[model samples]
Target chain A: MSGFEAATAVKRIGDGRYEADLDGDFGFAEALNGGYLMAVLDRAAVDASPHEHPISTAATFLRPAKPGRAELVVDTRKAGRTAATSLVGLVQDGRPVVEALITTGTLGAAAEPVFAGPAPAVPVPPLEECTSMLPDEGAEGFAGQVDMRFDRSTMGWLDGTPSGRPEIRAWFRLRDGYGPDAVSLALTVDALPPVALNLGSKGWAPTVELTWHMRAVPAPGWLAVHGTGRLLSDGWFDEEVEVWDSTGRLVAQSRQIARVGIGVRK
Target chain B: MSGFEAATAVKRIGDGRYEADLDGDFGFAEALNGGYLMAVLDRAAVDASPHEHPISTAATFLRPAKPGRAELVVDTRKAGRTAATSLVGLVQDGRPVVEALITTGTLGAAAEPVFAGPAPAVPVPPLEECTSMLPDEGAEGFAGQVDMRFDRSTMGWLDGTPSGRPEIRAWFRLRDGYGPDAVSLALTVDALPPVALNLGSKGWAPTVELTWHMRAVPAPGWLAVHGTGRLLSDGWFDEEVEVWDSTGRLVAQSRQIARVGIGVRK
Candidate 1:
């Protein structure tokens, strides 16, 4: 009954429409691993909306599915009290592929903090001594889905060099027994922008493309994330991450655009 | 002599590194929008080397411009061969506030194609031209930077409400802009999200954010962009567009994300 609950399955197809099937091993080798299809469409948009509130999702990836069954259909365009919006689609045999949008609500007083700045002391290190750098080895199949560590002040993973400071900070979670939900905390806050563009580049970086912006949604515990990156000489790279949760709050904010390339000179 | 006069100007050191005085108006709104502060530091990358090679330029904000001045400096960033890459940032007292970074070279070998899917189907129009569509109240303070198009197929302008999938479509641009360099190509090839949340959603969709992999820069052609959206239950909603060119060659490609408020509701 495990193995991502027997290779993912979810039907119901009507009342609120539901359909999802994945059969492939969850350690992802493809067959829909964009953060496990964005945590199965963020748990089918929280089962079509149960609401505790706090949402913000964004997805796009037109094609890339090939394991077996991958269908999802959720609906409900708008609900409002404060806000609510949904849309999910990721069909496989019939076409579609991937498309998402979720935007729950309940936290907008706009108190006026205006971005205080701080949050960057950097230093976590401890996931069994932390190591995994990953600039690509197929992103090491996401090294068993998070728990990553890293911290020497910064720039350690990927060993690339440049730690100048467009930023980089880590410490994520998940891995123990899973179950934090919210689509596994948005798949561990979408793996910190390819580890902050391969440690804020001095050389060698890869991501091709990635984007996340979840404003709020964290409660379960122990998360950190951070990242920053912004290289642009044409090799193109952009990262701006944020996720807090050990009580620091924030929760989520991501933006990644990569196409780096340059690490195979041995 | 175009290539934008080889660009040169940007220096505003009060000591923030590219400083230009502060408090708000951030560096005099980037020295009066000197082409949106040369497209935000023209791909930055400071001390690691690489500079020059951006192909386009345009900016216009006027007024503000006051920062520090020491004749100012401009040195964007660059690195190319077959992957092409560039960057240009500026600031000068008398006149000059440019930002550039136009790269072109990646997508190597594998060719053989001629436009297969999106582009050339135009016709849109319905959703009541987008529920009331407002903005031009005489362009007050510039109305959220201008993004109100309904979509009668590609060129509508801005308003709202439409849902997804019509071969993909939607619009919205200008988180900030002023015009010139074709208005930074209206925020570089606007309209995205697997074609704007699949234009209303029903089938076929994938693009968890892939602005053709961003990194190109240069602008001004106009501004005012578009993208209306919808794609329920499956999750998706996107907005962040701006791309103008008239005689620039790189036509259009905005941005969007949608999957509004999932199930339940009533």
Candidate 2:
């Protein structure tokens, strides 16, 4: 199985609970990424509901997760015609690693827009000119599974230049040929690096809390990720992301508050 | 008591369950405003936790709540050293009106930032020059409780001129003598009219779902609200808000997706 499919796959072990096979493929260093954990949790939520898509998710990181066998437990609170509510938890050794409240619903792919402005004005470079951020060697981590080609315009921090704006835009998709689904859109909304990077912060930015809403089912092709941060304060920052399908529709939108990196010398 | 403090005050009847007093003072027409409901919900969530603030809240509106008696139910999932997780539900007549997952934690008011970008650049006019949105006659309802002075830049839609950009900035605070607090911050984060109004949409814009995080405690003074809508499409629009305190600190941030008015013509 491809890594994205494997990491998000859950087998129903019965009684509103499922067994999730979490591997090292979705981790950064030894800890699993928050988005990946939410994706795993969402699978169970979707399974528990009559709805087809996980519409909204709010996840709080309680403990760092390691690659292992975990339990996906879901509690159905209410099920209505338009939406369903469930509390989903990812547990290891009977301790909660990530807990989320997810609401599932069905969104049509062919819904016409009454009114929609064009995508943000930043243009991406042609495929040949886009800079690939995939790692050079190993296929064991997050960067290895997804192809991220940045626009290079907002990536000036590499050359000691702070773009004076907290924004990053890129073209993204799975390296294993998986198209966008509601579950994968959860990971894609948080797939890019922190927008604080372009504003001169450095090192690993850890997300404290993340909440996202799925607007529509994505069309087949590349997804454009636009991330921006409104505030970067003492040890904290707020980042917002918009995911647009290649067909020019918004698939998902997310906002998160995270810890600023260790040292920001710029 | 002032409208805000009285509406949000919960009587702790027992363990994990409290009684909420809903009143029409926080309403528009017969339905209670979403922000006002969230403000009351945050109050109960903060009181149940050992921490002092409601750091993150993701609320889903399941049913419309009217002015009456309701129950505030709190379910603690994890109580960590720095943070605690609880599922809060507001029920009236044994049906869920709103349910939320709130993470409560401590944030310092006097903490110094290593770095912070400036507040959003759309400056509001001085208090003397600001335009009042309060209804001239009825001194009763949500508009009467909070003082909002608009920048008037995005209000050109009132005169048949669309700014072609979705943005709104205003100065706000409770008309009552209370200063900034966690409960009040929740209301302030969602206090303004929908930002989609500037894009030529009109009438009552209802929030489908909203998620917000408290970054820091606010100092005593008028709060500046900077609002923006990224995309308006498919009869839905997404709004993001940043609330800055008088001391120039980024206190709270929120994002919500709402449907357009009853009808749209362009």
Candidate 3:
């Protein structure tokens, strides 16, 4: 199995139950990446669903998930010819950690969109002009597994020069040679550094809830991710990300509301 | 009780359980407006949570809800000091119709956003210069409950000259004078007409999944609701709406993926 496929692997424990191990490599600090958790839950939902692609998913993060053994329970709500809906919950030690309503459908690879809007408003420069996020010593933890090249203009947060706006643009791919697919797009949506980073907020900005949609079946190559936020108030912020494939087709889109970390450095 | 309050009333029956009647006045033809269903569901989540505001909600419409009776079952996932999360489901005749993960919190009326982005990009015209959706014979169905005025430019679809762009902008408010609140904002987000109408697609577009956030408490008066879509492909389209309060604050935001009605008009 490929690294991503293996990392998100699920074993059927019963008719509606699944077993999985939260990969430690996907963690940031002590908390697992929310996107990784969604990918894990997507595997369980797809295994139990008659549909092939996970088209839409609404996930609520109940608590921080740690790297360890987990159980996925898929409760099929509706199974139809065009689509299927399932409630997939990731549980650890009998407690629900993350719950998601996943809707699956099949997409034709050759079909074109009847109408497509301009790509995400934020423009990203060519890959050669972008800065690589990999450090000279190499990346570790979550960054190590996902190769990313960021638009330098939005990376002012690293040098303490926030853009006074909430936005991030990056090109993403898996280091394990896993090509972008419907399941992996779930991970790609939440893969960018929190938009709050550009708003001068510090520390870990944890995602509370996230909803993503797969617009089309992706073609293999580097995926461009553009994220922007509309509001940051009362310690909360909302981020919207759009993923475009190499063929210039919009592949996926997502929006998430997250808590702004209290730990800030002036 | 006010019209909105009565229309969305829910009675607590047991621990984490409630019952409500789906109001027919909120229906579009025979189908209930997805926003009204959300308002009904939000009432149950608020009643069950210690918090007063439904901060974030991710809902999946399993089936079209009819006017009559329905049951709401709330399963508390976490009740933290800052917020509470619950899995609320609307069931009719022992079958689940709508399921949502609602997160509740308390927002201080005086709290200002730490940093707010520019409001939704789509600009709406002044209400006085706009075209009212109320027919000459007076409003009926969902239109009777929620008053809306559309920007003259976006009303081209009505005259068979579609703008050929997926966009809609309007001013919205409740007819019964309940004013704006977190609960009512639920109804405001999905209140706009489908964006696909401007794309020249015809008939009733059914929303499959919608996720909305309560950004801040409103300041009353009419609300500017701006809706836009990024793509429509393979019979599926996504609409995003932003609700700006009379005081010019963004009170709520939402995005929904819906099926494009197969029946089209030349």
Deviation in Å, model 3, residue B208 alpha carbon: 0.6
Q: Scored by Cα lDDT, where does model 3 land?
A: 0.89
Ten contiguous residues with the weakest lDDT in model 3 chain B: B133-142
The best candidate by TM-score is 3
Candidate by candidate, in order, the iRMS in Å equals: 16.7, 2.8, 2.2
lDDT of 3 by residue, A17-118 (tens): 999988888988778999999999988898898888888999999988988899999999999888899999999988999999999988888877888998
Interface RMSD of 2: 2.8
Among all candidates shown, the one with the greatest lDDT: 3
lDDT head-to-head 1 vs 3, winner? 3
lDDT of 2 by residue, B1-266 (tens): 75679878898989989998898777788878788889888888888999988888888777778998999999887797767888799999998888887888888878776556676766666777778765583666777788888888866776778676788888998888676888888888788877777777878777767898888888999988988877665566778888988887888889887767755545
Give each model a TM-score: 0.33, 0.90, 0.98
CAPRI-style class, candidate 1? incorrect
Q: Each candidate's lDDT (Cα)?
A: 0.43, 0.81, 0.89
Residue A196 CA displacement from its true place in model 2, Å: 3.2
User: RMSDs, each prediction?
Assistant: 19.2, 2.9, 1.5
The DockQ values of the predictions, listed in order, are 0.02, 0.44, 0.68
* Candidate 1: residue A39 lDDT (0-100): 70
Q: After superposing candidate 1 on the true structure, give the runs of residues whose Cα lies further than 4 Å from its correct spot.
A: A1-177, A180-205, A208-210, A215-255, A260-266, B1-11, B17-117, B120-237, B240-266
Error of 3 at A35 (Å): 0.6
- How many clashing pairs does model 3 include? 0
Mind listing the fnat for each candidate?
0.02, 0.36, 0.75
